[model samples]
Target: MSTNSWDPWNYRSGSDFGTGHDLAGLSVQATDGHIGKVDEATYETGGSYLVVDTGPWIFGKKVLLPAAVVRSVDVEKKDIYVDLTKDQIKSSPKFEEGGTWSDTTHRDEVGTYYGQYDKGL
Candidate 1:
């Protein structure tokens, strides 16, 4: 673990996991089915998250998903599996693509939305 609280992207020490850059563009699937592809990712000391672009599936909506919900990553298939459903993600806190996301309020709202799931923080 890192002492830097603001470090966006958490990786276990001595692990072989790839960084956020490696996850971008990978398809993200919910428990039910495919939701979208990862537009970007942020890994904080608290946890990690993925910004997913829903494309035509959801009228080009973009959403933020907690890394805790992520069950697995298939590098060969370019896929990421999460334990949430499409509706759960659709109803989560809206994610704006600017500095507002860095706000503690926004982060808290997001955290609250997924509070039922393990944060893995």
Candidate 2:
């Protein structure tokens, strides 16, 4: 007998209603209004993140958002709510293509940027 257990329902642990794999293509909504659609997502032991493509709104700029900032996922509405504003996300650390997501330096930079918002600084 095989000892490996399979959980189709729990394919993604800690996921709210949908997994990171299912997050792509979903619209990302900031506190004020819709920001963009998810271009991609990264799921790791440390954390998850989404790359949102701000189509036309900001000249097609993209941004990275930590999963911690995700407030909720509405499958029916096909939307992901984040506890931030358009200006906040627009001003956040820009996500560079090919950048290492696991790098401590990068993580610290991003964490610090978002931390400032939490402190209202």
Candidate 3:
């Protein structure tokens, strides 16, 4: 993982994905398989993230994925790929609907969970 795991929370550099495009409704693929669709996306410099609506995969659960995990974006196919497994996303801190990103506590919790790969978790 990158030393600053949360840095550059946009689509990976040189992936040719447009930052201004609407990602909501696009399918999101995990390293293993399809996980959900992008319910929301942000391109904020260091706080970018994706709110994925898991539909029936996790009983309509939604997961917040840090943009750092985004490996690529396929606008043609309308798919977003992330460098993470379903289990990894499943194990992340539970995200409540209608939560705001301004909540630093929750964001910190999320950052901590995703950053654990560096510690060999």
The prediction achieving the highest TM-score against the true structure is 3
Query: Model 2, residue 43: displacement in angstroms?
Result: 2.7
The top-ranked prediction according to lDDT is: 3
lDDT of 2 by residue, 1-121 (tens): 1233312111133335554348889999999999999987766545667778999998898877766667678877889887689999889876666876555566666766765544211
Relative to the true structure, candidate 2 reaches a TM of: 0.74
**TM-score per model over all chains:** 0.74, 0.74, 0.84
Candidates 2 and 3 compared: the better one by TM-score is 3
Q: How do the residues 24-70 of candidate 3 rate in per-residue lDDT, one tens digit apiece?
A: 99999987999999998887777788889999999988888877677
Instruction: Assess the local accuracy of residue 81 in candidate 3 as a C-alpha lDDT between 0 and 100.
Output: 85
Cα lDDT of candidate 3 equals 0.78
What clash count goes with each model?
Answer: 3, 0, 0
The better candidate by lDDT, 1 or 2, is: 1
